[model samples]
Target: MSRYPLRSTLFFLCPLFSGLLACFIWAATLPPAAAQERGGGQTPSLGFAPRPKESAPDKELRFLRDSTAAAAISADELLEDRERKRVIGRGFADLRFLGKRVQADHIEVQTETRDAVATGNIIFQAGNDRIVGSRIDFNLDSERLVIYDAKGYLGATYYITGNVVRRISVDRYEVIDGTFTTCEGDKPDWAFHSRKSTFQIEGYAHLQAPLLSLRGVPAAALPYAIFPIKSKRETGFLIPTIGYANRNGLEFSPRFFWAINKWSDATFGVDYYEKRGSRYLGEYRYILSKDTAGQFNTTYFKDKLEKTTLWDIKSSHISSLPGGWGFSAVTDFASRKNDDRSLERNLNDRVRQDTDTRLELTPNLKGIPGSLRVAMRRREGLRENDGDLFQKFPHITLDVSQSQIGSSEFRYSLGSSATSFYRVQNKKTTVLQRFDAAPSVSLPVQTVPWLGVTANFGLRYTYWTDQKRTPDVPGNPSRDDQKQSPLSREIWFSSLGVAGPRFSRVYNGGFGPFRDFKHILSFQTTYSYAPAMDSRDRKLIIPIDNVDAFNDQNTVSYGIVNRVLTKLKTGEGFETRQLFTASLTQSADIAEARREQNLSANPRRPFGDVVLDIQSRPISLIRFTHEAIYDPYEHEIDEQTTGLLLEGGRNWYLGLDRTWRRKRSRGRDPQSGRSDLNFSAGYGLTRRWFLEYLTRINNVQNITLQQS
Candidate 1:
């Protein structure tokens, strides 16, 4: 019964499934044959079947095939043999493997070994290297190549040609009977030929038996030469500089650089002058740390004509340490024998040779209240003209903080110094040692925003050890007492009070090109009084330091300052600028009335000269400045100077200056003046050309004194 049931079920389902299969076959065959051909017919079945395990030889062969097949090979005609695993391509054959490409007229490749040979106009390219040869043999898997009768371009900036070329790696090559040049075309402007040469990419080239040629003509020969192929710092001989000057005749300077380490380098050079003697120069640079660096240079020459040896040395160093300590030193020293005749023609060199050398070290301490610093310095000078220099060997100074006084509004400061001033001239030395201490306290009171006042009191004390030299008298017999050493001390006190009121206003209306305008007016009157010292105390005091005895003064100085500021809108942002400023100052001596002046019993004049200063920039391109000192009592201007500057587009500029000095002698005319005028202008004639002119005129003499 079970068998019969199963048979029945199959009998019913079999016919239905047969009918569906027949329908599918009919539908598949319904497309036209032409359509099937155009679509390349049905795709072959990719069966889901496991492959046999590969043997070692099979795996090796597969690896070689894969390496060779990584790139594509194409040709107009191709012949392949599967049995031998070889391919032969002709008629414009090309191959590309990895990043290397090769094109040839005829090519042969062995897939199993990944080897290739090409002949007849072969061109190969890899990275920046391009090679053209008659024949090439290459191994794809090893990336080794050998070329015969090859010429190539290296980095597109250099050319190399050789009878035989061998590539060792991507960045290294060896050539036999090769020529190298930076020029183009059949005949280059300059070239080097060598018997054997080796090139390292982005590094350098080494040549054996190199001969330099210019325009196909041999110029120089070297036993062996090493040249830089990359623009990097390396230890090498630099290109010699050749020049000719009227004073030096033909000059040749050759330099050699030594790359001592990553942070230091030195260059040594020799300059040969055909007319003059040779000069030796050396420069050294070092970077000790991020914030510490230094340079030292020296130049020495022996002049045959002058029969003297001259040398100049310059060195500078700057260092910053932790805890706000800093140090700097600059030294410029030159030979003293040729002060009148300098070996260098540059004015700046001559000035440096005559200048002094200075070294300084400073340590600072900072806090919320203020900062304090201590400095030590040394100075030395060279040349006869610098003989009067006040040499300070290890002068020390201390500046204390300006701290608040006991939590009050007053602030106090202290400054002290000990210095030794010495002068050496004509084999004679004079020295003066001094110690100075000054302490000051100030209270700044601001009753309102517009009004402010400050009261200050200070005391200065100084002690000096002095050396004096008296002048020789023609008819006196005190020559033996010309030298004396005196010790002295002085102390003084000073008090000062300053008060001022400041006013400012802003206007919102647009005026011409200005978007807004403001006016600031400040007026200040200062009255100072100090009583004269006693005659007895003044006689015992000698002024050896910068401090002087107190002088009797009772004076009032008044000043008015006016400023006009304008705001303009710019493409980037709003800009505020001061358009104009004017100031006037005058003083009156209050105690002058107590002095008797003339035979008519008139009191002395109390008013001093009036000073006016004005600076204005009415337009963006023009500016004017004027300053004058006027004696109101004499009705004359003592000194006056006015300057005007105009700047325009594209290097166009003009400047005019005039200065006038009036004679102060009583017999001279009050209005008589000596005037000088200077004019300078610069204009662009073209984008690359410009014209500049400068001239000075003596107006009183009606003559042009200088023009350039």
Candidate 2:
């Protein structure tokens, strides 16, 4: 193992540090290499046995392992001299000792010194390393070998030829006038020419006075360089990306990957914006066990033109805790309001409007027949500098599974949570503590095939501390409000939900591939009322979240959902799929009798807009979806979205979507002009190759918003 087991990285570094290769040489220091089983350490005795005279004249001789040494030798002829304790072999001479082998046309050895000399096409082999030269001088005692005019390869990749290759010691080597390359064939794609190079087996390779050539053309100059060798991932410079963009000019990004260990790794790089500035990026990943893993990625950039610095970060973690507990976390954060627009590198991530950071834990509460959860959540707008943001911390919740009420026709479930709410808008910040609990029960009053009725009722109690009556705004509090006397509120709420008269029909499909098709329809309604609080009482409650100011919702929401399911027979079995789905919903606010619209300041009629949604999948490959909101007063669609999709399970895909709006705009909100069409398509040329195209066009602007 080379000091850097990922030696492939050196192939690129050698060419990059060509001129400086001669200035650096690392002396790798590691534990000594393992030696073959031997009778004695370091210097082992040597023994030689010659072929018997009675054997055929052309038959070669073989040596037997004896007490003197565990070495084997074979040759066409062998001669021994007791006076000098020397042995000589001629013709096809081979020697194997201490896990190393040597082959030569002729060989001579001094058994006393444990030194050997070989000439005429000498070949040496040790471990995975092999070398061929005309002559060699080796010391079995020191296990040091030097080959003259050597040419061979290292680690199955570095093909090296040198004037003199010498193994100074076990796991250490030096080569003079060496030229090496990773490319194969008679002519390599590129090669490094160096005056001298040294190797620390399974560690690093150092070269001096090295020059790189690409396709026989000199590419770079380096006096010296040190390269770490590791498998696959390594600590080294990676291939750089270069391109030209009108906004960024000539861009170049260089990256480096560090394989910290088997379970962890990291990558650091710098992206050149040319016109803007340089951006530094880093990512780290680690796995502690099969169920534990985490990763973090971050970026920092300072724009010269904009004269602003920006930062972005992303992280995710999942782990299994002791005692049947699980934990996970996710974060996407930006230091600046528009950091996503200024610094986000991912196309999809930049289009998102907000960043959500959350951490959650699920624990097994002993003897509890319900799930327990603890979590903290934060939502930040990517483009909002001073809008209200939600920050909930230490939100603890428990959900008890529905259980029978003494074997009665009624069952009940309990759900409750306690949370600390923190909200910030502009320069003001609001903080409050909230505790809520709700327990609900349902009775199956009717269970006929055509008419089914289920009635549900629940009571919810909530308490808020450190609260201040906020103005009638979208969760925005002024800075001075924090100084006002804090107040607390204890509120009670109730809700009722009913479902009945669900209709269904099954149609035998003698028509397409569908074996059977069924259509089902259901109607559901819920009425919720919270004691209407006076304006002053409501003001005592800070609107820190969507649910905070809503202690006065005397409203009812009713909706009908219908589905068409189709069953298809696969070769293995049968599968059911919802082929079509549709829903229409609307709600009336009776307490207020009028509610403001999202984009308009004026309160509208009590009757809310009717929202209709439909989805149809006639076949496995084709799908269609549509949604529309009808304004009762305007008698027109206030907003609409529709899309179609065609899927090719393995090779192709197409999707087209359009969004339209009639409402006016609010500050910093998404534009609501003419419909915008988004189209995307992809086709696979081969199993491993594909091409895709995507574009978004704005009809109002009459320009392409985005295309790729």
TM-score against truth, every candidate: 0.53, 0.59
Output the number of the TM-score-best candidate.
2
lDDT of residue 227 for candidate 1: 50
Report, for every candidate in turn, its global Cα lDDT versus the true structure: 0.67, 0.71
Q: In model 1, where is the ten-residue run with the lowest total lDDT?
A: 1-10
Candidate 2 has its poorest 10 consecutive residues by lDDT at 30-39
List, residue by residue over 646-703, the lDDT tens digit for candidate 1: 9986558999999999986788776777999999898743222345766778999899
Residue 504 displacement (Å), model 2: 3.2
TM-score of 1: 0.53
Clashes of each: 0, 35
